[model samples]
Target: MADFAWSLGSPSLRLGVTGLSRAGKTVFITALIHNLTHGGRLPMFEPWRAGRLLGADIRPQLHPDVPTFDYRGHVRKLTDARVWPDSTRQISELRLTIAYESATFLGRSLGRGKLDLDIVDYPGEWLLDLPLLSKDYRAFSSETLERGREPRRTAIAADWLAHTSGVDPLGPADDEAAGRLHELFAAYLGAARGGSLALSMVPPGRFLMPGDLAGSPALTFAPLDLPESGEAPRDSLWALMESRFEAYKDVVVRPFFRTHFARLDRQVVLVDVLAALNGGREALVDLEMALGEILGCFRPGRSSWLGQVLTRRIDRILFAATKADHLHHASHDRLELILRRLTDRAIARASFSGAEVDVKALAAVRATREATVRRNGESLPCILGVPQEGELLDDHLYDGKEEIALFPGDLPDNPQALFRPPEAGEPGFDALRFLRFRPPPLEVTAEGVSLSLPHIRLDRALDFLIGDRLA
Candidate 1:
């Protein structure tokens, strides 16, 4: 019914853009639309390369309730101020109308084809909440508690764990107690996501990123130590927590699944694979589990023209490892392979459901340009760019304006090596550095026209994502 209503209003292909925190969802959408609108170089995009892609324009979507993607403001910040756009916090929409000459002879005879591309930007953290639908409060609490007890999480989750240990599920309902537990639990989640530790299994995902539901009772509940094979008394704290958990799944997760996720014709899940690598084997394994849950939420399947008209199914899934600029071009393929390895199971699941799934390593906005420097009388591949202020590496702190060339470590050829425990003498993730870089300065033409944001493999990604639709 939802898809029918959506299709009745607009004949557009909806693309879901989502990623884990700091995976560059905002930049990808901004750069993609900017390149198409400004005619930025897109050789790998078939329609753009063949001169069949005429032009593109952003159109206001029919839904007034959905906030429009702030394309212009983001462009102003990137081009005029030379800074990255703020990360997305809430859901937003943008529709790009592309006028293109059709590739087929018969298609050309019919005249120019215009494809309305509806881009839906949402936080991947929300997608992490999907599994909550099937999980009861007891199960959810059990899983979250088990994760908190893990060795890696022991320190970060100490306060929450200690506090939760004292809370009884069958105790009298106390709003203050629930709120306190929520605070410590949320703190543990936030700390786990910090730079030094990149754990990803923090679910009730909205707890960490509570956009509008911050202090509401819907967000106040926390895990409690429950007795085995027990029932909660009607007026007990467990009952309140369970009711709120159900309310969260009802009020938050289900609506998103029905209204937005279920309507997507395609999806690209961006992963900050480098950060996961930095956190070592446990983080990598956690990421894999999170991805499995994420992949399972998607309704991926092959649809005939008639089938598509009747129901919306995501027919293509792109799992992109974002921030390719952090590594040199020499390791891009290795990076892609590593992501491919990480998501191999999820890809199989999607493929079995009849969706075309592919993976790539991409930097939506290329922050660094490549260079070669001689060190110890040997040429070494390095990337030249400005590191953000206060970023410390090798005992040198960047002032955010000074540009420097760096040999941002290479990804290993064997993707499996990343998952295995390091050998005594093995130069592992500890040996590498992944520093954040500011957005590159835009290229200006002689006439003072600014070109589109530079990128790596973005064109190819677009080609695989929407090329067939344009054709």
Candidate 2:
């Protein structure tokens, strides 16, 4: 018999599952926990595969709320139905413990250990904004301005852009003007959040709760005043901007960074690259810009004395292209190709600092495979998967057609593309085409786990985050 308490002597790993809105954070968390504890149908997730995973018992104390997160029921719902709508709300604090056999530590023989995984299932939208706390208002506005001009979008941003352009780019940081812009900016951001713009900067529900300072002046003012103006007045929007910027850094950014981002042993930056591609050329551009800007918050390229003053605690970063099950098996590489293009700037900027950077195409759920629909005998790259639930998920027929135009749900209408493709191969892929994903089995084996990995990536993520404490 395994020494349950003795195995408890090992350190528990703290994992934060973050991704863009609709990027599958909840489903992933649910599937991960369900598979880990119940050994239900799930993709192979290493440690779990070694089979020595003693039967896991999930108690309310470890996980606290169970009804709020009916993981098994959610999986059943998605798999049973022919179609599963995307997740719309944010659910928080779902924890699960997995007991498994681990390789011996140093001279010790192999024995069982418990992975007390505490998972935070947040809206990917809010998680993506973690990097935004670093930027000042002026810089934020400047970046937002560029993103507002993408060709393939139509929304509040268009109107906001008009207002921003009319505001003298070189004018003083007038407080009233800045306040108006702030409201407009917040509205635009809220709209973007609601619209499905995949930009990493938009905070989840921030659109819903503009906070107590909703009608207040905008913070973080970079003077649009000419360089010749020298210094603007202290009471100007510039000062309000400065104050808010400081507050954001101290009040908002600092605590999150210290408690979560800083404390994390590893990170998974889930990018919806396929969704961006499906949104077409404009979506691609916006995705790149947002990703680059977000990554910039962590890298700190050239040290300002202030830059030296503030630093993020995240040491290792994993940029993953989520929803891999949406693509045909062959197109996985192509999906990665598109992801590389979107994140090239961010990756390059991050790699220089010696932080481990990896790009992966994955569907934590493993939804479907590429197949062809022969309605008119036209061969197209299509996705194939079973539609039944429980162990019957694969018992149904393969369905779906080539998505001519895919809506990335709520992304901004017009967004920027960060990188240009090196060259297009035989694949006549538009920026907006991608394979739709299917869910993984409720019960999976070690080999199943391996397929889910674009590489030994999860192990690497865990190692960086928790390996130091392994005994």
Among these predicted structures, which one has the highest TM-score? 1
lDDT of 1 by residue, 404-462 (tens): 99998777899888888777776788877888898899899999988888999999999
Residues 1-471 of candidate 2 have per-residue lDDT tens digits of 112453355455546566666666655555455444544432243343444456455543243331245555665665555244356354344446666555455423555666665555544444445455666555655565665565543565776666666775445556668667666766776666444454445542233333332343323222232233344356655555656655655654445444444444455667777665555455567667667755664566455332454434455666677766655556566666667667877777666464666666666565554455555765555555543323212243334422232221222221222243334342222433333433433433667642221211233334344444333
Evaluated with lDDT, which candidate comes out highest?
Answer: 1
Lowest-sum lDDT 10-residue window in model 1: 301-310
In model 2, what lDDT does residue 19 have?
A: 63
TM-score of each: 0.94, 0.65
Candidate 2 lDDT for residue 295: 67
C-alpha lDDT of all candidate models, in order: 0.86, 0.51
* Model 1 error, position 40 (Å): 0.9
Residue pairs with colliding backbones in model 1 are: none
Name the lDDT of candidate 2.
0.51
